[model samples]
Target: MTSRYTLFLCALILAAFNLRPGITSISPVLQGITRDLGMSSTSASLLTSIPLLCIGFCSLFAGRLAHRYQSEKIITLFIGCIGIATFLRFFTNSPWYLLLTSLLIGAGIGIVSPLISGFIKRYFPTSVAPMIGVYSTSMVVGASISIGMTTPLQHWFHDSWKIGLGFWCVLALIAIPLWYTVIRHPYTAKQETVQTQPASLPLQNKQAWLLTSFVGIVILLFYCFTAWLPAIVEEKGYAASYAGMIGTISMIAQLPATLLLPVLLRVIPGRRFWITFFTLSEIAGLAVLCFTDITPIVASVCLGIGGGGLVSLTLLLPIDKTNSAMEASTWSAMTQAIGYMIGAIGPIVIGLLYDYTGSFVPTLYLLIAVGFVVIVLGWKLTQPESSQLEEQTVYQT
Candidate 1:
């Protein structure tokens, strides 16, 4: 625990705090944005999903970029860009400009997310798990704060969602200087490069496809809820602030499950069985949402447990199944890139389905079907990785 590493820890936590609030804070106040911009449900859903696409697309390239440049410098630059993009939201009058800024925000976050994992492993190899827990919890804090505060800010600032949404820029502004000062130091500059081994593009491996799609399905389900849950609750006669409050509760519920799920999977065997149980949790949570109007809080908590657990567990599988650090990194990059792109389809699909049918019933049923697909994929996950094959992605360095 040297002072240098301690500083790395601070910068990382701060950076994690910025990653999601800029992206997620808009969810609670989406109704405001829609009305302010005169947007349809489908277009609004696109706004949310497009950033996810950028995150997925950029994540694949982030690894290649990190190999060519100093990761700390890359991280510092992206963190600053997130502040700029979030601040840009304050002046957005048209939907296209808003989407453009969302793309910028997503790229900054996408690069930071994968690179932070590598950074943690490099600087705190022996303490990776604990540091991950600390930073993951930091993300949860950021998301919940955004969900809880956005509505209040809207009301406080003369009923303007623009100010409320853009308020998250302050977090990025704070994180940028902290990360910059730490990374500019000499200690981080002299680290040896990590030797990498090539693994096939995820498309080449059938099992990898299963893993990618399964995680993507989980992600799809996760975003569908996040993107529209507040609006749905509002349709049910709750205030936007109340919807935000419930969203906050859902986010708070996510932290403990996200922290603990991977630990449970590691200590206990039967990866298939645990995976099935987690997938069932998603189906069950969606069922609750679809069937019950009497208990939104109950449904939100259930959804949180399912979403957090599935995301954490899926992330763990890439590492557990890979043979080496390079293989693990490859699997993770491909899985996130491909799977997230697939997952990004969820929000827009839900929006379009709702717009077409004028009901959410079809959307919920579709999500439940995706959950069953995850169950099937989880069963196949019991099979071992394809290690003997030489197929792999081309690396730049």
Candidate 2:
């Protein structure tokens, strides 16, 4: 790669790094937030869900916004919004305030997510899979660091959860400048905006809906695990520190898969095989958590590997299925918009199930069922015949 291309790649990865910390940081310090704000489990879950909701809703418009404006500018602006929202958490004294910050943070992440896919399609079309691996790996890095550090940061700040939650703003601040350089290069900006015709979202495509549903189920599993794993481990008799470590371990474990899975897909003969393999890994992890009191280390490793692989594939599909930056952006928007809305339910339902039954077993059972559904959808969607037929249908429309 050229030096300029290398710089843009660095910027893209840095920006991706900012996306997950806002959400992941909350889980480790959730108990403190509940104790401080006097909120119950279901209400506290809104902290995670509300942003997911915003992500779903805001994502619907990300493509249109990028089509009308510079993608880099839109990305930089939202990253700044994320920074501002995260910084405000330092002053959070009420549930409403915390929820509002979550909304802004989610909105920022929602808009940035698909545009990054578009960037890959536009700039590195030949390397979409590996670039997505790098992108997704950066997100895992951010999540691992934030989840791993939040509780310790809280302790260091004399038990101030606000500091733990708010400290991640530094990531956004770090990303903005690096991303701004992409816009400052006039040639890159010019190339990004050139399109023979604006790409319309595939609202009428059946395969798009299949992709959306597949994205939804997996994300639902992911967010639920991220939001509740710490508490679930704690309920299983681990100390708070150990519980946080479990979550961090899972996030950290994703790193290798995120970097390697896409490369493996290029070398492997069948996509469905990998999908089934990873989906089964997730189910096994959940089953272990549900049925046995065994140490969670094995489960964490299984989940991290499975989640990392699955998410890398999902992120790749939009680019693989589309022809242009704008098309990829719109396709990504459609999948993530509806997908994240569905995902937003995972955390809330888990919280409600726990509150009502005083147990997490029902929630675990629900995720296992969802995992099976994902396997079927993933198998259908990645089939070569299905992909060819869907591409013809989408282009003809």
Maximum-lDDT candidate: 2
Candidate 1 ranges with C-alpha deviation above 4 Å: 186-206, 266-270, 321-329, 384-397
TM-score of each: 0.89, 0.95
Assess the local accuracy of residue 56 in candidate 2 as a C-alpha lDDT between 0 and 100: 90
- Give the per-residue Cα lDDT of candidate 2 at 218: 87
Writing each residue's lDDT as its tens digit, candidate 1 over 1-397 gives 3778778888988888988887688887787788878988999887778878887888787666666677788888888888899899888889898989889988887777767766665665555545666667788888889888888898899988888888888987787777777767735443553656334445677777778877788788888888888776776778867877778888888888777753654456456666677677768767877887766788788777777767766655665555543355567777778777988899999889888998877888888898888888777666545422112211111
- Per-model lDDT: 0.75, 0.87
Give the C-alpha lDDT of model 1: 0.75
For 30-71, candidate 2 gives per-residue lDDT tens digits of 998898899999998998899998899999989888878988
Per-model root-mean-square deviation over C-alphas: 4.7, 3.3
Name the runs in model 2 displaced over 4 angstroms: 186-193, 389-397
Clash counts for the predictions, in order: 3, 0
Best by TM-score: 2
